[model samples]
Target chain A: MAAIAKSSFRKTKTKNAVLPYLYLLPAFLIMGVITFYPLIYQVIISFTNFETTHLLLGLKSPDLRFIGLQNYIDIFTAALPVENFNFFRVLEFNFWWALSNVILHVPAGVLIATLLNAEGLWFKRIYRAVYILPVVVPPLVVATVWTNIFDERYGAMNQLLTNISAAFLGNADPIYIRWFEDVKPPIPGFLPGAPLTLAYYAMMVANFWLGWPFMSVVATGALQSIPKDLYEAASIDGATPVQQFWGITVPLLRPAMIPAAVYGFTLSFNLFNFVFFMSGGGPARSTELLVTFAYNLVRNLRWYGVAAAFAVIIFGVALIVFLITNRITRATQNYMEA
Target chain B: MAVNPQSTKNMFVRIMNINTSGQTAGRSLPLWKQLVFQLIALIILASVMFPIMYIVTLSFSSITTRPSKLELFPKEISFVAYRQVLDRPTGNPVTFIELLRNSFMLSMGVGAAALVIAVTAAYAFSRFKFKMREVLMILVFIPLLMPAVGLSTPLYLLLNQVQVKECKSGETAILPFTECSDGGKGKLQFNLRDSLLGVGIAMTASALPFAVWNLKGYLDTIPRELEEAAAIDGADANQTFWQIVIPLAVPQLAVTFFLGFIGHWQEFVLTWLFLSQPKDYTLAMTLYNMTGQYANSIPWNRFAAMAVIVALPVAIVYIGLQKQIVGGLTTGGVKG
Candidate 1:
């Protein structure tokens, strides 16, 4: 009797174990083929000298050459065959880009959300409604439209600048600023290695507009979580509004803001379409991001092995960012882990 | 005196405010302060609306070519740009309707495909007490960390393998060989990597993880007692899942599908990389193409019109489903 019960129990256990994997099979099969396979394949190709020429037979071509760590070394040493490519400069600029975006966006988001959170504000719904517009507009669209706006000739940006110049400075040569093509970094040596071109400034302005709304969404979520009585109590204690804000609101928003900043760091670190589409990495790849560089290595450059190695390096950078951010914020910890 | 039930209920409502996106009435600010807040909001809104208004205005103008003036609103509302856009979106042989159809099919097909697969997997995650659950979940989600564009190279090579090549024997052989030992090496007949079908297949990979993650979270909320009760009433496990869990999870399924659908709709990189033919060009692909072309050749008004058209579906969906969409996004930890 004991043996029979144990067998049945074991049978049930085995059955239950198989069911989840069975359910997971279809999703994972597609994922394995499409996502996981490519990732694994990328890591493998990073060591080999894979290019478009070898694309026909991939890994098995008679002409395919294997050069272990050469691709990685080239990238690190800035010895890449492609012109105007430096790994460190791009990486540094990536960090700065993310940091600058966060500095501007987080405060603006928190401030706006806080104002909206102030008990009863008129048209609060409308204000929040407008916030969704940016969220709905994909980064690709945002980049494209902003590029149009900043056009040197017929762009609204030059027009606006011309209009402003005529109004204030009393001189306007159509305010034709080559926002994208002009690679002369306005602030030379400002961001060492990476040139902060006029395109960078334009991207910043556009990204700021694209960015703050999402941050505001996140900040609003945090703001709603703050107990209202804390504010009321501060008011009763004769604390000034500014005092209340700094003391109560800032501390409360820290938990959300830190994680948000971290996530934004990684997002902007790898932000491809916005930077790429804006000016095609800004004239000779001066404004090229790591991801876009990887993209170009494949699409335009056709240096497949170099692209794979670059992608692996990027993956490493992302992993490190994720790990460090995950440690600091534990933001990605799902409910079970938390 | 006991704690008032009404006040407790109010507290609960306030606590759940994040769910309703905090639209409930809290204590009103000072009237003057409220006015100040209003002023700030108006300024912010104006700034956000600046570029959007330009695109809308430009799309409606009588000018077929790119406008050279700073017109925030249309001087005369003409439908010519819209008509031309609808008629001929770009220099490509494909029509606006064809582009729409391609985009619609891909998004909807991928959305539905991911949904079906994800629901089953999410149900497993929610219901099963499996050993590898945590590890599996992490593995599924970790791909999102890698910049999607980074994965394009491998996907490019992998999908490139599935093609039909003609042999020296004047026969077509469909094989999964990147290095083809051909029945024929002369004519390349069908290449999966360059087709719309292959593009959809590749996109579904990126879409699946998000789908699984979103549905898993929703599925966890469903009480197991319903399934238990169904089991007690002689329902099988499969029956309980289909009849019980799915119905409860329908709204969430819609949420997951739409969220993934939005991304799929705007997907540019993989589609552009994979597809070469104009017939497979999505709205986003075409939009990016217009921007890449020579400045003089680009029909700027039509570009603006297409921009409006592309943005319309997303805006309308978001406007219609803000509460559900917003709630879903925040809970799922939005990408970007």
Candidate 2:
């Protein structure tokens, strides 16, 4: 009787252990087939000369040859005969783009949030509601809209510029600035080969409109969580409002702001849609990012092997960036860890 | 002092006036500061609204091939663009209505499918602990770090391999099935490359990871007491999950669905990469194609009309759920 009872208890334990696995099966299957498999598949195909010939039969094609890191070597050595291509230049631009955006966005966000949180500020809700408009509009739409706005002939931007010039200099000759097509870098020698072109500045303005509202929103959320009594106490201790903002508020908001800034950096780094749709890496590939260049290899050139290797390189770069940011900010960590 | 009652009343009035003035002085911006703040606010608002306002106004403007001046507002407002949007000037096979239906169906399907799979998985992650739990959780989030555009090439290849062709002639078919004799004389191939459903599946690969992470975060916050109570009353795991947990997760489900739907609706990459057939074109693809070689050739007003139309649903959903969307965004900073 004792032996039988022990066996039955073991049976129940086994059944209980199986339940979680059963629950996880569906999610793992979907993710494994669609996401994980493709990721691994990409890695495998990157080593081989995979292109249109092998697309039909895939790995089964005997014609599929293993090239053994030739793709990687080609990309790094700049051996590929593609126009307007340089790996290092694109990487530098991508980093600078993300960094510049964060530098602008985070402070602007905190300042705006502080202003909105000011005593007796009217229409706070309206300001927030309207500000979030840019955040909701898809990046593709934003890109197109901004492109149209920057159109040389009928674009609102040039027209506005022309009007301002007309008022000041007495020349209304419809100032048609080649916003997208201008390859000349306004500020030269700052970045290696990747000059900050007029198109770059135009993109910055467009992305600034797209990017800042999100940081402000995050900052606003963080600001609200700070207790009101702290401000009162600061005031009681004879701290000026500006002093209180710096001494108390900024420190307290750091926990939220750091992570937000990191996230913002990552976002602007891999901002594919806005860059792709707006510029198409135009005017001599001056504005091309790593992701966009990788995509161009596939889309325009149909160099599958080279594109795959480029993608893998992008992944490695992204991972390194993520790790560095995580170390600095601990963005992914729980609050308890901090 | 007792004799002078009028002086006592005057003192009381003076004290009340001092209190009112002091209260007003505590929390008001100075006149110049106020002016500066208002000016800055209005300028930013105008700049932010410029493109949107341009499109909104342009949709109402008359269709102009060449405009000598950049007009902020139309001299004559007309609905010619809207009518043209409905009419087929471009010789595309799919009509506007058909494209709308396909887009709507595809987005909704992806939303529902992602939610269904994701909820169960999120519930597991939230409630149950299994072997390799940490490892699996990392796997779920791994896709979030990688650039989505990177995966398109491989997914295009993988999706093409499973192309099931109906063997009618058997000569053209890659894999000829000898069993089916009742089918049409000409061969039929159901390649995943050309279908919208296939595109949704590809989209779900990206959407699933995000949904799982977000929903899991939400589910983690939900107290387990309800489930414990249900279990104490002799309810099974499935019963507890279905009756208690799912109903509680409704708001999150809605958020997940709409977020996924909005993204899939605007998805251009996979559709552009995979779908060659014009019949499978989404609004995004059509809009992209409209920006073809001749920017001048494309009707400005009609394009603006399409832009407004595409933006409308997303805008409505966003406005309606601003609070929740904001909440989701900050927490799930992982992009959809």
Candidate 3:
């Protein structure tokens, strides 16, 4: 009788163990329906000539002709027409913008966090709250405010620059720069009387301003968590502040830094609203990133299949970065342990 | 050793020296240096506040003035923009009131649904050890990493097929039901694209991962002993979860609900993609439409008014929930 009861009890326990997975089933099902289905559907659509009109008409199949790698090749090698935008230029701009974001974001985050973490810093809470204000604001509002700041005719930036220039040049009237109006010629002297442009550069400045605050907040939080004793011990050993920062702060902050860098990299790549609202990726297609480019392809041109292809490419790139960062961080942590 | 009357005084002096030495070693720099550092910090703080201050000023400025000439203090304070936004149209106009109603209803629906689903699932994940627990956790992280823009096209395609069912005379029909005819009149059709349900579902999907992640963190921090004690007192798992775990998790639930609510309330891209019809537009989309197609017309004052109206409630809620927001992040960030 005892043996029988024990075996029955074990059976009940085994059944109970499966209950949590049952609870997880609904969420998994929803994710599968929403995320995984679309991912697979997109791959299938990429080979087809799906366009917006066809989508509206509910025409089941679009001649699924296998244009092997033609879309990808066209994206990378396309030329810009005088009146039309080029996909390749957009891709190139995306690469440059993502690289610049990493360059600015990581260093700026570390610098601000370090300043805040300085010894005898007064009213630390006030400064921290102020720094985090931008992160809480809506993206559209941020873009709007930046548009005002970057306005050519009546912007604060231009006004300030003009004043400083007037002071230095000893002139009553200052030369006004039309920041976003100029356009670069295709080739040097090939197109006569063409204007060279810095419109894309101006847009990048706005994006950097919006992105840097979140990076700083994340970095500051991580910096504060680093034990003060570690810095004190290094300083006591006759090390300068810079040496202590490099030796103790940077090494210990790597865990936090890795995550923030990955986030920054992904954000720069996927940033759409700011670019879409502020620059429209123009003066030409010089400021378009992958997200904006894909959006424009779908919304403007209605090339559904090609847009899906771009989306797939973006997903792959983001996945690769995420995986690489994860691997590097894990290895670093293991090395530290050893 | 020879005992001396003055030895006790010397011992007390030695103790005081040790205490003072340690205190001095750890004491931060002098007040003057601290003040200088603070002044530099104050300047940085001012720079951070500048853009927000400019927007607030512009919101109160006259609608007729150019965006560039707008001052920190409006020369003439006027509520023309606000009045225009609030005033009902002379002849059955679809005003900001309707837009707000739509947004509030949609946000609240999505938030409530997400909370119900996430809370139960979070409890299960936190309380039990299961075969696929780790896999489920990792799967939840995928949505966080994937950009919403990437999913827009695919979601559009899938949602296009979803249709409402109708039952009449014991025969189920999907509306607006259509049948192909050769050289004849075809059936009428209805589109789900402009419906609130479509936008709500999308919002819920986007908000789900964050809600689940946060709730799971809170659930983990709840001591298992409480549940076990309840069980010993003859309470079932359902009863224990409802009576004990639910109450304990209220603060976290509130935080997730607000975050999800605000996000959906201000969402643009998905709504823009799905709801192309003008009449179905949300408040944020309506504000966006006021600006030109390329957003170049610069409706400076009117745009600022809309922004202020939208931001006011959010800022108030944020300040009120400041402690919970910080506490939630402190726990969730470290754990996740």
How accurate locally, in lDDT, is each candidate? 0.79, 0.78, 0.66
* lDDT by residue for model 3 (B1-336), tens: 011234344443321111212223355767887787777778777667766776677667766455544255566677876776666311235777787887788778888778877777788888988777788887776666557777777767667655543333333334324323232323324456557787777666656776778888888888889889998997767788899999988888888898777667777778888886655667777666544342355456666677777766665666556545644653454333
* TM-score: model 3, chain A: 0.83
Instruction: List pairs with backbone clashes in candidate 1.
Output: B166-B184, B166-B185, B167-B183, B167-B184, B167-B185, B168-B184
lDDT of 2 by residue, B1-336 (tens): 002223344443321111112233345777777777777777778888878877877888876574455566666679998778877624586788877887888888989888998888898889987788898888898887778788877777788765565655554444323324445434447778678877888888888888899899999999999999998897878898899999999998999899888888887777888888888788877777655234577788877878777777787776665557666765576432
What docking tier does model 3 reach? incorrect
What lDDT does candidate 2 reach at residue A148? 78
lDDT of each residue in A210-314, candidate 1, tens digit only = 888777877887776777789889989999989999999998777767667766667777788888888777677778888888888888888878888888888
Error of 2 at A195 (Å): 1.3
Model 2 per-residue lDDT at A37: 94
Give candidate 1's error at residue B266 in angstroms: 1.1
Model 2 agreement with the true structure over A1-338: per-residue lDDT tens digits: 99999998798678768877787788789989998998898888899898887766678899889999999998887788977777888888899999999999999888877877665555555666677788778777777777777787877789888888999999978799988888888788867667888888898999999888877777777776777789989989999989999998898888777777887888889888778877887778888898888778777777777788888898899889877887756544554266
Q: Which has the higher TM-score value, candidate number 2 or candidate number 3?
A: 2
User: Please, what are the lDDT tens digits per residue for candidate 3 over residues A209-267?
Assistant: 66677667556656757777887787789898889888988887776666566656666
| Candidate 3 off by > 4 Å | A1-11, A56-92, A118-126, A166-178, A184-200, A227-235, A332-338, B1-39, B68-70, B88-93, B123-143, B162-190, B217-223, B228-240, B290-298, B319-336
The TM-score values for the models, in the order shown, are 0.90, 0.90, 0.81
